[model samples]
Target chain A: MGNIPSGINTPEILVDVEKLERNIARVAQRVSSQGLKLRPHAKTHKMLEVADRQLTAGAAGLTVATVGEALNFALHGVPKLFIAYPLWINESQAERILELMKRAKLSIGTDSVAAVQQMAKMLGEKAPKVKLMIEIDSGHHRSGVAPAQAVEIADAARDAGLRVHGVFTFPGHSYAPNAIDEAVNQEHKALAEAACLLRKAGHQVKRISGGSTPTAELSDNSVLTEVRPGVYVFGDAQQFELGRTGWNDIALSVASTVISRHEGSADIPRRIVVDAGSKVLGSDRPAWASGYGRVMECPEASITALSEHHATIDWPEERELPGYGEQLRIIPNHVCVAVNLVDSVLAIHPDGAVERWDVNARGLNY
Target chain B: MGNIPSGINTPEILVDVEKLERNIARVAQRVSSQGLKLRPHAKTHKMLEVADRQLTAGAAGLTVATVGEALNFALHGVPKLFIAYPLWINESQAERILELMKRAKLSIGTDSVAAVQQMAKMLGEKAPKVKLMIEIDSGHHRSGVAPAQAVEIADAARDAGLRVHGVFTFPGHSYAPNAIDEAVNQEHKALAEAACLLRKAGHQVKRISGGSTPTAELSDNSVLTEVRPGVYVFGDAQQFELGRTGWNDIALSVASTVISRHEGSADIPRRIVVDAGSKVLGSDRPAWASGYGRVMECPEASITALSEHHATIDWPEERELPGYGEQLRIIPNHVCVAVNLVDSVLAIHPDGAVERWDVNARGLNY
Candidate 1:
């Protein structure tokens, strides 16, 4: 609709403000209307500005993946922070968590009893203040204790003087083709049983947290008090391919320029190289993800392959292809990993002006 | 072989200095014995310390992938830097290159005539001083012009007042399973023909650069003036799988701590979850690569899957699985991508001391 900044760099992250606001409001409305607390995961954008906007839109708190990520948000005065993924609290991380706990209400996820014990010993007397949520396996089977085993871990956490929160699980298996509804059911069943176990153990199960972008809409919110979907705020190609969101719902993409064009032989498709590659767009092609990333304008083109600095998009024989220096918006397969690949994002306002936001919590995997 | 730093952070990059030195020496000696210059690519580690070590080990110059990377090395007083990438010269990047050119002798890759014209116009009078390497297709077909068409682009570069030095081709296709020898032959043929084309046009073909870690040793130096191998100094799982290096050659790995251990059913292998995942190790499996990465000590444990913050490793029945708090060294599938994912790398000295070296050129895709 308008010209980008003349001096803008290629292979850069760009967020359409209008679309971003719409996506945020839409998710928040659905969660709030269902009477569930919305704690959008910060691992997607890793920007404090995005967190602030979500908080402004009635997010209960922010959910992160690591202690370093939580520290980034805590430094910016986000009072309530939750490290949703199960973490093995080491000395450096525990010390950092101690500093963060003094500034904010912190919560962490633990899957194993030994990890809970180590966390308690690492934090010493301050462990009680930090809320602990036992992650239960909701059929994903990646990380998280079984629903039947949640009571033992919760009891052990309480014995170690840790504040036991309810239970949480990531319905990651929802990402597979035609598996969203089943994953949602599994998440609900897992959290419900895990919370029941905590309640039977005489512990207050206040938060039965569960979600993922694909299953957030299909989730049985009655069984959970909160939903934590990270990718819904900035829909990616994986979300689009799964029919979880429409193309209009995609807010973030890498603004890439056509760097080279190679004429293919009769048997091969015409190879069009773009500046954006794995380094900028991230290589997260889950079998179903539409060809690395979708070219927003050129739907007919299939991105055949990608190297570190070049994306080889095979253009249809009939469709007109872009020449060198032409720019394209690439909706990456996984927006979270793509955002982590950049230092900052260019947010283009409705008025067409752009502002760069620092990816503050980026590379905070520790 | 020794104790890891207990107080250090998890999901961190660790470089064994002794192993790293050995790798550097090995490649340097091989390249030197051939009477061909070695310009190690900085995209692998992107650290000043690594670049310094490479230069001290008799590397003629350093090769980088982007202008932002070149600027990082130039600022550190590296006398010569070659950006072996077909960069789309934008206004901001051109301005940055102008500043870098003032600091170091700069050479860049160009495959198209339009790109050459744009680069020449950006540099203006100083364009003649910048050596231009015409990229030729060597079966990879990712980027670069065909070997037969190299003279047209080289002549166009010369007409635009750019110093047409020679030709270069990346045998990137060598990374595939059992494709190294074929890719090497392709690279040699492409560079030889392209250099011959340039020389026929009365241009002095002083340099013929070609290499990739997989085909570096197999490369015919009689047809090439120099080799640019980036991953040799930090052998990854992909390189090891291709038989280019051994486990002992893998000097860098993500020092990740076990966060969770899930007991699997009879059918499923025992799952060991670590804090390091795609974010720390990078999402570059290349289909044929060893599942995500490899656990150095637990060779029988294969990393089955990786989410943003968790690496789900499948420990074979015969192997002894790790405990909840034990640490493992994860040699990533692609060391370059893994190094770029971090802010700094931990250099573990022989004396048991560790120092963090900043990944200065990380996220410098522009």
Candidate 2:
């Protein structure tokens, strides 16, 4: 279990340690040199080892998508953490958040007055008022209050005696190819508007945060003090599709063995079925993706379809297909979701020796 | 966590221990009463506990999608296991298959001569030859050899001194609502044709395995000797959309809390955002699905969109939405993938006691 033996079985998620380190270093260096703090999203890797590398590479703190993720990172001694997600504050979550705050310097996100009020009730003379960041809907329309409403929420936080840290927005629309620039522009506009609104409302908008993997490359660091780019560390098919990164930048792949072959036929040409299917590789083929996932070796070929246990790969007529049992690495469309699906990832060194890292944060869905 | 605590969080996956037991019993009873052997697929739960229940419910064996899954069940002492997937035979898988054969009766699926030949080479001089199941493409067209070509692979398996046990196909196309009947009919035709072809080729086709959750409900057991239905134990959105099961039959859900609220504007109506997103709930919204998933309490509403950490839920006009931090349960579109994303599932008893079972087969991708 220490070193993933070579020819490691099918549907196994393999991470090239060398490439991963390089990917981490590349992002860390870019963010640090820009004088902006890098709070790499732990939601991507969900692995203690990868998070450690991000911290080692000069990350100011870590960003987690859930309280459970925050707890896992805290357990690994990640000192400063941001629960980037706008959590719903409940009695159970309040208890968990209070306990987590005691263990680490934590900041939580919220977009509603009710949430802040609930947080105030939970804090109630214990451990001081928690820091809160107002989430603004910057074109994603997924979460967050409107920029106009940000001031109201910030005021509510202040009224609740909670420390208002900053404003945050996720330009998740950036995931679409050719939408990165628009997303970054939207991020800047939303954060600027929200910051102005908060300031007008007599609150200090100290930290203006925005940036997804796609927009991070073109982010306006002047308006935003921090950028949370999760997937940059291990570029995925989404990043590639969005023109944010090249295939060479993809640092992770699910290594799988070809288990079945359909020779050239009149109707269907050469096709190979791999052991990696929806169960392992995930069934996340975004509307923009060429297929469910891209084959690393045969980039032209897409995973046409996936059964629960078999990846149906249709190769081009001109391309030579690998024989049955041949192992091929696949770059998944969405790296974060794929990472979350597995228990552990094979961390392979430059010399090809592989180390196994437990996905300690594998299932922190609570 | 031995007993799931009361108010055991919203949007949390709860496996009704009783319902799950009933589902197991019902399926097992059908198999037994019909005089057909039951080989429950472990890909759905990926839990040893669930597999144990299947066995205890009179399952003749267990069916798995991967060698890794097969190994997991075998380790848990399930002596008979079928790797129902058309596996690509590699050196590592071959070695593992040989080892698995030592502890459990192993049946593997293949669709190519190359795979059969490779497996044959790997099983050379083994105590017992691995049983082979020729996968026939019964209109699912995802994987499996052509029904007419089943004998080619069956003959190859026999020539390799492997036990050509039977033929198998996944009526995966039945997952779509309109295609269920057609897929089931095609499955019967394919199985019948393959069985006849194998028998005519001087091979005994003892098993005719075909059935997915959608087709299992109306499957003609008279034609097939065995039925492999994985998702029936915990019905998912696919089953519901396919009209295979009602919402009451869904056994698992992700408990999420409403984190944010937005008042209606001229352009947009009132909305509530939940903490559960694609990462936890999985981004699987088939065209027929109401939304990304079904809300347990508010079945009328639909989750409009999902960012990595946010689920944007739209409500009808003037409806009182759940307050921020109010817990809500979500039934994901695909339960199998959602379960695979998490490490452990919280099994909730009727009395509100929660037991955490190790997803022993959680990341057995290979």
Candidate 3:
């Protein structure tokens, strides 16, 4: 990565365009080789530039987690968009989705009969091309229904005059250590079973979408037609630590200045404090993760704790601590959360020009 | 504790103005009773309306984390502001701060001679009544120098033509369970020692500031001239779980919709999924925190995991799960981080009128 501009402020998100494009291209190629369509999840970057790059790199469509995000991308003229979340649509949101449907080919996810009925009730007879994918559990157990239960949601949607566009599952369990193989296996099985049940129920099981960044490489195309991996575009510390990506593949980082450095005392260990804390880096440290985040410049350094405006890096006494005012790039454990925290990100190009990309879909949680 | 407006969307921040005023007044009265000046940290709410409420409640000044935040408040006509962070000021930041000094009485925290020298050099001879407070490490061990080292920093600042106003420390250790008394005690001792050292070296330590929300009520006025409690204005899950504040005292909460609900199968446990996740309610789950956040309606339930837009609640099967589209209030583990995630908050008044309060200093993380 190129050096951050001295004119730019510290504790800012810096996206390396070269690595970003390479990461997107590599994933596109891998998905193509596996005979699967890539519907890259736009929830990761939430930037129009990143979404445009992914679409230009041969992504079939963009997957989002909210109607607001879908509308944001749709308004930006993304032809096809998928809200890959089981949304509990209110009347206003339903109206917004209906309006969005006129601009883009939109498909939302539903795991329950109640949500399907609510959408149907909100839209009534004026509903236009309402399409939904039945969400399957796939061992995540957070959202989505059981493999057999997908048929019930599909039946409800079909009865409610909404088109059932096959099934989808999020292998959220893949985020953990050594669970990728099992998560991928469960994902495949759940999608296959759900698709079979839907087909048996006389529904056209056209798309079986399933994939997380961790299990994207091992995804099987036999039962799945499209994969929706979000974090592949910007490799995070989680991906790197999980052996999914290399140091060179990390595209997005927080450019932070070391504000404080301390030598070991009897009560405290030697540490360097950076301005990028939970507000910038986010506080998404999984149980298995090494620390709050990983320092790209000093891999051995562990960010032991995070205050709102400070990240305490536990430096090895052997290595010299970074000097005060020295800028260091940090890879957040989860890049999506980090990206959501900022208004815009600084994108550094290979030609040494840095541009700011607005996170247009930021904070569109609804 | 009023019903959320139907027009407002889900996963949005809702501030109870009544509780907010009460929280501010209660803390103000307590600090006043102890004869300590209240300089509530603006980092928690970052809203002008909330800051105004605290100021009206007799806050001496506002405390901020960065120069950008300080400038935001200063521009909003807050007369006195303290950047309660050990900032590594660059030339540009120094220039901004220099411009800021013209409008407000500003004091910044410093922990090292290098930072003091950098600030002094950057401010040049045109520096306007520069006030520097030596930060002492009062057992948090994140930033701040040792008690004896405070004199060194104060000496450097004094030698550099900067006024050493006093010393301050963040009793961050108080956030944990049963750590309040010890943290307050240590805070008192650290400030006392640092003030004594600075006094012995011929520096007039006028304002010895200390106090976090957990230790604010237990603060010793004998050593501290001012208590800077940020989170007391908006009680969070941390404060509520730690017994620092009652449930009725929580002012800010995320209004979320129950998007999906699932009964336990053989492999999965029963859970209710809400739209408000880590993006709305930040992912700061301290080791001692019960979960990601707390549900006001269902205190018995635990938010087991959070996705970017989904919070999985481990709802007890004994009670019927909330229906789809039902709105519930969630108290985030860290109110400051949660407040920073949104552009504006909906402040519900006592008479049922809801007003939008723009988070003016939302992303002003320098």
Per-residue lDDT tens digits for candidate 3, residues B163-263, read: 88899999898888888888889999989999998898898999999977888777757899999999999899989989998998888899999988987
Which candidate would rank higher by TM-score, 1 or 2?
1
Sort the predicted structures by lDDT, highest score first. Answer: 3, 1, 2
Candidate 3 regions exceeding 4 Å error are: A126-128
Higher-ranked by DockQ: 2 or 3: 3
Off by over 4 Å in 1: A1-3
**Scored by Cα lDDT, where does model 2 land?**
0.79
- Superposed by TM-score, candidate 3 places the C-alpha of residue A120 at a distance from the truth, in angstroms, of 1.2
Return the TM-score for each candidate structure: 0.97, 0.94, 0.99
Q: What are the per-residue Cα lDDT tens digits for candidate 3 across A1-366?
A: 788888667899999999999999999999999999999999999999999999999999999999999999999999999899988878788788888988999888988999989888887775437668888888888889888888888787878888888789999988888988888889998888888888888889888999779988787588799999999899999999899889899998999999999997786889999999899999999989999989999899999998889999999888998899999999999999999999999999999998989999999987
Which model is ahead, 2 or 3, in terms of lDDT? 3
lDDT of 1 by residue, A142-211 (tens): 8988889988898898788888877899989999889987888888988888888778879899899987
Name the lDDT value of residue B131 in candidate 2: 74
Which number leads on lDDT?
3
| Per-chain TM-score (chain B), model 3 | 0.98
Better of 2 and 3 by TM-score: 3
Who wins the TM-score comparison? 3
Q: Per-residue error at A184 for model 2, in Å?
A: 1.6
Lowest lDDT 10-mer window, candidate 1 chain A?
Answer: A1-10
Which candidate comes out best when scored by DockQ?
3
